[model samples]
Target chain A: MNDTSTRAPATRRGKGLLPLALGMVLGALAMLVGLAEAGRLKPREPQTVVALGQLLDAEHRRVDLMLERGDMAGAIEALEALREQPWPDHEAGGDVGMQLRHDVYGRLLRLRLDHPEVLPVEPQALLRIAEEGLGESYRELDINPFTARLAALRGEVLEQLDRDDDALAAYVEALDMNSALLDRELAEEGAK
Target chain B: MGAGALLGLSACTAKAPLTAPAGGVDESAAGGDRDDASLRAADLSSLELELDRSWEELRTLEDSREPASVEAGAAGPGDVVDRCERIRGLADRICVLSDRVCALADEHPGEERYTSACGRGRDTCTQATEAADRCAAG
Candidate 1:
C-alpha cells in the first residue's frame, strides 16, 4: 500500500511538470518569433524637409507670376494648395510647414487687399491666419522677404481703395520696418 | 470560475459593443454642432469687417482733396485732373463694395452691426461717387 501511494503521488507530479514545461517552451518560442519579426521590419524613412522647402519656393514663385498676370483667382488657388498640404507635426520639424503656410496666407491677404473685388471673400480670414501662425516671429526670422513685401503691397492696395490716410499710415509703417531690415542686413554684412 | 470573474468578463465584453454605438452617436452630434457654430461666427465677423472697411474708405475719399501745399504752379491742371479721375475710380469701387456688403447683410439677418454698417457704407459711397464725378467734370 505504501509503494502504491508513492507511485500515485509521483504520477500526479509528473503531469503537473509536463504542462509547466510545455508552457515555458511555448512562451520562449513566441518571444523568439517576435524578436525576429522586429529585426526584419524596415526603419521609417525620415521626411524630406528640403523637398518640402523646394515645393514651397516653387509655389511662391507661381503665386508671384499669377499676381503679376492679374490672375487673382489663380494666385488664390495656388495659395490654397500650399495651405492645405498635410504638413508633418512640429515635433517632426513642421516649423517649415507653418512658415510656408504663413507666407502663403500673407500673400493671399495682400492680394485680396489689392483686388478686393475679385477675391469674393473678406481679407480678415487670411490676415487672422497669418497673424496667428507667424506672429512677431515673422519680423524676427525675416527668412521670407515676402512678409515685408506683402506689407508694402498691402499699403498699395489700401491706397488703391482710396483710404489715403490709412494707406499713408501703412506706408510709413512699412518704410520704418524696411529701414530696420536694411540695418540688420548691413550689420550682418559687417559681421561677415 | 468564481461569480466575480464571470461578472468581470461579461462587463468587459458588453463594454465593447454597448459603448461604441453610444460614443459614435454622441461624437457625431457634437462635431456637427461645433462646425456649424464656427462657420456662422466666421461668416458674421468677416461680413461686419468688410462693411466697416468700405464705409471707412468712402469717408476718406469724400474728405480727401488736393493738399493745401499744392499751389497752381506746383501741380498743373493735368495733375488736378488726374487726381480727380483717380478719386472717381475709387468712388466707383466703393459703391460696388457697398452693394455687396448690403446683399451679404440681408442674407444674415441677425447680424445687426453688419446690416447697419452696410446701410451707412452704401450711403457714403453714393455721396462720394457723386462728389468725385462733379470734381472730375469740373
Candidate 2:
C-alpha cells in the first residue's frame, strides 16, 4: 500500500465490449449470407415469360424459313429439336409457355400429317404426342388459336388411327375455340 | 315444222311470269329482327362443323398453294394477307358462334357453363382480334 506507483486503477474499460463487437459482426455476416442464398444480392434474371415468348416467335420464323426453302424435312427436324428441349413446367412457364408448347407441337404434327414420309410417326404415337401436348388443364384456359390448332391436329391424328368418335370430339373442341376467337375478333373490329 | 306453227306452240307452252310471294316486304322486315334472334339461337354443333370444314379448307389451300412471297424467316406478306383472308372467314364463323354463346350466357345468367363459355369467347375474341389486326397490318 505504501509502494510508489504512477499506474491508473484497472477500470476494465473494454471488458464486455469484445463479445458485443464479435456478435454484431457475426450477425451482419449471417444476414449477407442469407441474402446471397436467396439470390437477392445477385443481378436479376431476364423476364422469363417475355424472353420465352420471343424465343417462340424466333423459332417460328426459323421454321418458316425452312419451309420457304421447300425443305419440309428440315422444318420437321427443327420442330422436333425444339420439342427435345427442356420446356419450363406450368410453374416456371405458366400459360404462355404452355401455349407456345402447343404451337410447336401443332406445327410439327401438321407437318407430319401433310408429309407422312418425312419423320414418319405412327398413328398411335402421334395421338400420344397430341394428348401430351394438350395436357390436362389446357381446356381451362381461354381459347388460344395455337391450342385450337393443336386440338385439330389431334383430331387429324385420331382419324389416322380410325378413332372417328374421338376425332370428332377433338374437331368439335377446336372448332368451338376458333369460333369463339372469331367472334371476339369481329366484336373488336366493329368497336374499332 | 312451220315457223309460225312452232312459235304458236312454244308460246302456248311458255311458262307463266314469276311473281313475288305476297307479304315479301314484310317477310324480310320480320326476318331482319329474326336475324339477331336466330344468330343467338344458332346451332353451335352445326357451326362447329362448318368451322372444321373451314379449317380444312384453309389448311388445304395453305399447303397446296405456293407461297406467293417468300420472306427470309417467315411467311410472306402475301401469305400473311392470304392467311388473314382465311382467318377472317374463320373469324366470321367464330363471331357468329360467339354471339350465340354470349347471348345464351346473357339469357342464363345463373348457368356457370354458359357464363364460362361466354367469358372464354370474349377473351378469345380479344386475342384473336389483336392477332388479326397484326395480320392486317402486315
Candidate 3:
C-alpha cells in the first residue's frame, strides 16, 4: 500500500510534465509563426517569377518578319494569334507578361491604325481593342515604355473615335508616365 | 563568358570589309581629280549597298532563330553564361552596318539622299538594339 501510494504521485507528476512540455513547444511554435507573419518578412509570391522571354522573342520576331515581307494582313493575323495565347495573371506570370502584352497590343493597334484598309477594323472596334488591352490592373504594374506605348496608342484610338476629351486625358496620363521614366533614365545616366 | 562580356565582345565585332574608307584616290586609274572624286562617290555607293546587304543577312539570321525558340528550345537551354551570345552577334553585325551607314552619311554633308539613308540606319540600329536588349534580358 505504501509503494503504490508513493509511485502514484510520481506517475501523475510525469503525466503532468508531458502535457506541459508539449504545450510549451506548441506555444513557442505559434509565437514564432505569428512573428513571421506580422509583415516583418515579405511573403514570397505563391508563383515563381514567370520567364516568358523566349516566347515573347519568337512572337515579336514572327510579327517583324511578317511586316518585313510587306504582309500587313499576315502581320495583323499573327498578332491576333498572339492575343489568343493563354496568358497568366500578373501574380503568376510576373511583370514581363504584362509588358509583353503591352508591346503586342501596341504593335497591333499601331498597325491597324496605320493600315486600316489591311485589317479593315472600324474605329469603334479599335477603341475596344485598346481598352481591353489596358486591363483594369495595368496601372498597378511597373511603369515601362511598353505600358506607356499602349497608353499612347489608346490615346490615338480615342482620337480616331473623335473622343477628343478622352484622347487628351489618355495622352496626359501617358506623358506623365513617360516623363517620369525619362527623368529616372537621365538620372541613371548621370550617375553612371 | 558572362553575358555582359559577350555583349562587350560583340560590340567589337569586325567591321564589314566594305566599310573600308573610300579615301586615297587611285590617281593612276582615274587620271584626273574630277574622275577621282567620281570614283569616291562610286565607292561610297558601293559601300552603302554592301552594308545594306549585310544588314539583311543579319536580319535574316535573327529571323531564322525565331521559329522554334519559344516553342522548342534556343537550340538548347539558355540559363548558361553564353546564352544570348548568338543574338548579341547578330545584333552587333546589324549595329555596325547601320553605324557605317550613318558615318557615311555624316562624312558627305549636304546630300539629301544620305539623309534618308541615315534615317533608315537609325531605324535599323534601334531595332537591333531592342532585339539585343530583349534577348540578353531573357
For each candidate in the order shown, give its overall lDDT on alpha carbons.
0.41, 0.51, 0.48
How high is the TM-score of chain A in each model?
A: 0.49, 0.71, 0.72
Question: Could you tell which candidate, 1 or 2, scores higher by TM-score?
Answer: 2
Residues B37-113, candidate 2: write the lDDT tens digits.
34222222222332333333323222222222332334342132355665655654445445545665676678776
Error of 3 at B77 (Å): 21
> What does the lDDT come to for candidate 2?
0.51
For A1-192, candidate 1 gives per-residue lDDT tens digits of 011221222232233455333332332222223222434111121133333544654565465456556577887777766666765333332333334444556556655664567746644454444444454444443332334444544545554555544544444444444334333433543576
Candidate No. with top DockQ: 2
lDDT by residue (tens digit), candidate 3, A14-120: 33455333332332222223223433112132122112333555555566566556777987898888777766566554454455566667778877887889969
Q: Can you tell me which runs of candidate 2 are displaced by over 4 Å?
A: A1-46, B1-138
Local lDDT at B38 for model 2: 41
Off by over 4 Å in 1: A1-48, A88-91, A94-98, A132-144, A147-177, A189-192, B1-138
Q: TM-score of candidate 1 restricted to chain B?
A: 0.39
Mind giving the per-residue lDDT tens digits that candidate 2 earns over A97-123?
Answer: 566577678777877887899878788
Error of 3 at B67 (Å): 20
User: Where's the lowest-lDDT run of ten residues in candidate 3 chain A?
Assistant: A1-10
Restricted to chain B, the TM-score per model reads: 0.39, 0.42, 0.39
